[model samples]
Target: MSITVQDMRKGPEGYAWSRFGLPEYTDWMDESLSWKQTCYIGDWSFLWQHRFTGPDALQLISDYTVNNFETFEIGQSKHAIHTNKDGKVIHEGVLTKFGEEDYMVHGRGGYWLSFNLDRGNYNAKVSQEDWFMFQVSGPNAIKVLQALTDSEKLLEAKYMHAVPVTIAGHDVYALRQGMSGEVGFELQGPKEFSEEVYQAVLDAGKPHGIRKMGGRIAMINHLEASYPTIATDYIPAIFDADMADYMDFFLSSMPSFAQPAYIAGSFDGQEPSDYYRSPIELGWAKVVTTQRRGYLGADALAAEKARPHRVLRTLVWHADDVADIQNSLLREGEHYDFMEMPRDQRGYMWADRVEINGQLVGTTTSRGYSYFFRKMLSLATVDVDHAEIGTEVTVVWGAPGHRQKSVRAMVQSAPYKQDRSRGDLHQSTAP
Candidate 1:
């Protein structure tokens, strides 16, 4: 494994190591809670970075992804998804426009860039960079950022917006985005400057009670926010055979972690299943625009719109029932049926096979405890009838011995959090 200097810098500070260099610092949940109840700093450096630039950059990006890049003003950002020819999601990330032709894509998967390069019609330059991402979140996050730079403008930057600033004499990109469902900002800068930037934020935030958080706390907040991550729920589409040979070659040249795997594809020797999802099924319909000319997967997605098969909905598992399953297994002296914490398998979990009442309908992607709401929540793709709010349904929990066990789950709105921090940060009303 190739470890960058950035890895050494963050390891002592408590970050997890995956196949990729620096995973999120989930090991530091205790420290996060102690400090986040007041203030906390988290390492988010593992997020991959892809830069697209050239005369036709915007046009190429607009044609490649589902979101309308034409609508995004310079210095603004939007969440977007890239679907396959079959209309299944390959990658999802935040697209930030830095200049007329400059854009950065931040997410776990990098095969999307290779897919664009292989399409090869547009004259655009694409490259990947090594950068470290750190986020300071909590009630005191703004105060910490305000003291780091002379740019008073950073203090007023709206949520989901970004501004270039200098921190501890190093150039840093700061975005007012929070995964914790709390008021916060994320800092991205050169890997060489990781320690300095982290120290600067800590120093500035100490007076306001800042504490360093680990990956566990960050994952807890991610569950609360219901944020979708690539490779965790859905695999990128480059692994599909429909792509040209050159595209496959380009993907092979990428780093191991960056390469697309056949986790959810039929090439893995598993039968094709409904674990795949279109952008519309993932609550990203707003980003799909047919008003513009055709883009990748446009035809397939259009057909899907005319005859949609399933819709996305949130599931609230019965607390008592879930607890009872755990208790029963303990009484039988058998291992627990499902993992107590959240898990991300590389392949998609087949939704239809894991249904209740012998009717295969939807697949569940993310499941976790909503600490803020005091309930267990899951994100699932279900048929229209069961997609309504307050609908009762059953979800197969996990495998019986080597297989997943089934459990009863209830249907609810897409977002289980009554008070979404993303919306809370933008509203005129105070929390």
Candidate 2:
């Protein structure tokens, strides 16, 4: 069942109230700082999850996703990518392996998997499960986990590994992962313990300046940390004919899934595939294995890999030009697109056109003001030629049909934040 306690109906401005009760908790400033100096906790129960269990579960997932499951083991998780036969990414998410035939996936990745299982003669049974996930992250996140967990093993869990932790007299699974590119644990379990665990964690985190992070400020990590999101960057694979029934079920299940994408980019292509992105284009190049025998889209991905295309990078907006847009609100005239702090609540893709030398080159998405960095940053996918460090590009800001102002930007390497996610908590168990 969906978390419908609060009226989730989108506000006039395209904002939805998160399960956190309020839209904005504390302020964007303190919440933004919580991910750096202190810690922040946010509820991510909104994400859809599907559990697969059966004799053919592994094989069913192997044929649907791009992850190499030959070496997959219990307690291990991977950022699995699902793609069409043409190698275009359909959806991607975190896939966790529990038993040999048991798996849990978080995100829209289940769409492709469900589509395949329904059409194919697989013995796997797919059951959707609701989980209340709380993302507790920052430099001091482990501090709270240390106090709650009885086992030192939970505190020392490896990256992407899930360990059981006792919090508020309940055993919840804490996945050692990072959304802010820092030391963090995503504590998730039954919804009954959600309220109890949430309070326990908040009380435990009080000394560390633990702040309640709302949905608005929670997305800023993706900008600086370079985590590409669904709908915000690439369109899901719903246009294909085979997915007609799935779209019907998808839209009927969640009416908000029908949000349209706004494509305002310089890559003027006509086909639907033109709007699609490959696994490699989203900085997941390492996950695609050409050396392996075969998987869905493997051959096509290999072919696409042999060609030139756009890659993910960070674009730092010009200081004066960004200020000019903000200062416009003080004046009496129409202003450049208002850069909302932390995130943009608008539904559309909001992809801004990027150009160099008056020639269209790339597209930028996930535009936001990162208070952590004290600068306006956006994640962009530009042609490999324009992805060089310090390459200058101009971003066309504002909705279409409006006289847009040029915001100068420079290309920088993604993962602008120093990665502390894989750091060791205690002494190594290695010999």
C-alpha lDDT score of every prediction, in listed order: 0.63, 0.76
lDDT of 1 by residue, 1-431 (tens): 22322332233233223322234443444443533365678887877788888898777777677776556787787786777667778778788888988988887334565566656788888788878888877766666777788546665677678888999899888887867666777898779989999999888987877877644445455545556555434444544456555345555655544433323111122322233568877767777876654677888887777677777777888887778756766675554454554333322331323265867667776566655556777777788766777777877654323434456788887655443335443231123
Candidate 2 structure quality by residue, lDDT tens digits, 278-387: 88788888888677646778888877667748889999999999888788889887766676666666543457788998887888887888887888888888999889
Model 1 has an lDDT value of 0.63
What is the lDDT for 298 in model 1?
84
Among these predicted structures, which one has the highest TM-score? Answer: 2
- Displacement of the residue 339 alpha carbon in candidate 1, Å: 2.1
Indicate the residue-level lDDT of 294 in model 1: 64
> Would you estimate the TM-scores of all the predictions?
0.81, 0.90
Tell how far residue 385 is off in model 2, in angstroms. Answer: 0.9
Candidate 2 local Cα displacement, residue 174, angstroms: 0.8
